[model samples]
Target: MKNRLLRFYLYFILYLSPALAFAQADVPAGARAAALGNASVTLPDLWSLHNNVAGIANLQQAHFGAYVENRFSMRELTTVALLAAIPTAKYGSYGLSFSRFGDELYSQQHAGLGVAHKLGQFSLGAKLDIWQIAAEGYGSQKAMALSVGGQAEIIPDLYFGAYAYNLNQAKLAAFEDERLPTIMKAGLSYRPYHKLLLVAETEKNIDYNATFKAGIEYQLLQNKFILRTGFQSLTNRATFGAGFIARHLLVDYAFGSTTLLGTSHHLSVSYLFSRRQAS
Candidate 1:
């Protein structure tokens, strides 16, 4: 019975992957980003390397992060991610991020290099990624993709962003007869009150219905702690999360649930060479 279920799961993921050209990744970006219902294109931090490259400009010092997520409480479905970034006043910010999903039976890994630069109130960024997909019985394949993003501060506390991933629609493998999805995203983030933030975004893909995401984060205890909640339209899921900060160390936790997919839990830890300033 377990064998049958595993086979079914593997085939399901494969169908959603190369065959359909869906851009959804098995490993999500980060717990904090996930908590924002993955409406992270405008949010910045060390993990922005995987979320939105332009947001990496928010980093003022070197940063490192580790993240993990469990989907439906399955070990083989767990995801692990690592990220690092260095920001310099002269050259802007540079980042490297990697993530691995699944076991040997069916696994995928992503390695990415990204850079972001800020000019006045505008930020521009780009990234190159290598994706490796392996199936125990099927042949493994590798592909490279490129992404670019930009963000502008319309007002002091309001920001607008645009991002596109796999912009060239890279082919998975010629024999596979599939092309990567070209996903375009746009969003705005606003801070109505000193301690409250709100974000909304829309994502479009050629093969899938457009998705709308919205999230809110509130700071408590003078930026040492936080609370977040959000919702996604396509999956009809709600998410809740919190963050704790101590000196240069950070910890984040998130929980998400859908009608059909049960629940997912995520945790992330990160460190910044210099602490962020409070809003």
Candidate 2:
């Protein structure tokens, strides 16, 4: 059974994943982003290190987060990640992130250092990533890539965000100009009420068709609990999730389903510590 599953996974990677570009590099990191259909370009949170680095410019406290995801209920397809952010009241924010996906047969790793700075109502950020791709019995390849992002408050309660992954178009292999996936995303987020949030985004891969996504989130009990739901167009997936907050800790879980790949489960935990005082 394991062998068959691994083979299927290989086939999916080679044939289908290109069409679902999100499966490749720059994958969504946290459970919150997954639960929200990846409409996270405008969201400001820890996972922003992987989504839109600029979003982290809003952080006023130090944060640490860990995340895991089991794709299609397969251990071989699991992904694990760790992230940390430090904010300097006068200098802006800095972050570190690492994530690994897949099993021994095939795997990908990303380690990145990022920085973000706020300029009045607008924020800008960038990350330098060290990436490694490995396949059993075939060795591994390493490369570096740069990513940049920006976010701005367009109005009192609305935000606009955009990011470009692999801005330098780093090469993965020498053959046929084979390179890491380059993707672009833009989105809007609106907070019509203190407790209600709505998001919509469009993503494009240089080699694939554009995709649309949207999500909604609601907070209850004075911000102690949260509920979220979202949809993706091209992938035809629906996602649901909830979050709980206790003091400085946050826990989130998400469930996503698709006709092609079955169901996936995602979970994450984050802790906030020490707010930076304005200088």
Candidate 3:
């Protein structure tokens, strides 16, 4: 009977859900970004590969991370991702990331290879992504998506970023006819002092209205601990998150509230293979 119900649910989404919307790619993977209301498009973290592929091109060290988010207490809707980024001496930085959503009954996944190069104060990056959708007894579909992004420092402590996803308007589902949503994003990050950072972003998806977001991060305890908070206009959600960075380890958690979807919790852990030196 459980299998029967699961099959029925799959059929329902296969036919009806596309009319609603689809963005397995938009699920937030970085907990710090979630805490900041999915405003990480311009943040300087390797995990930003999930939000904006170019955001991590400037990272100086090799980093690996894993994270998960549970939405409204539904395990099937939970999102999980693993990411890694390495900086090469001459070729710029390279990143590999994979993200999955849903359960055995239905699922979506993305595997991507990304590269970024820094030219003076400006950084340019691009990601090539393979997207897949699968459902039990219904087979699967695969397609490729492309994204390009760039970021630059307007001054010593202020930065701007922009990226576009699904430039080809890729389609998903082997049997069903559906197209991946193309999205565009732009944002800014400002540092008023050594320990405080502020961010604002705007994102537009082809199928929906534009979203506006803002976030702030503050470093404490000599950069050992961090506090973060942010807000989003799309869902009227507010988020808060905190982080603990000790030597080579990183731990992060985020919580956000919304009206219809209730609340979401995100957690992530990362390690820096070559920890940054103290300033």
Which stretches of model 1 miss by more than 4 angstroms?
3-28, 275-279
Tell me the whole-model lDDT of each prediction, alpha carbons only: 0.83, 0.89, 0.84
TM-score of 1: 0.92
Q: Report the C-alpha lDDT of model 1 over 133-250, residue by residue, as the tens digit.
A: 7777777778888999988899899999888888877776676567666788899999998899999999887667899999999999999999999999998999999999999899
Per-residue C-alpha lDDT of model 3 across residues 132-234, encoded as one tens digit per residue: 8787787888889998888889998999988898898898754465788789999999999999999999999887899999999999999989999999998
Best by TM-score: 2
Higher-TM-score candidate among 1 and 2?
2
Best by lDDT: 2
Query: Compared with the true structure, what per-residue lDDT tens digits does model 2 show for residues 1-279?
Result: 997977776656753343332255788889899999989999999999999999899998899999999988877778999999998878889999999987777788989999999999999999999999887776888889899999999999999999999989888776666678888999999999999999999999888789999999999999999999999998999999999999999999999999888999999999999776666
At residue 126, candidate 1 shows an lDDT of 96
Clashing pairs in 2: none
Clashes of 1: 0
Candidate order, TM-score descending? 2, 1, 3
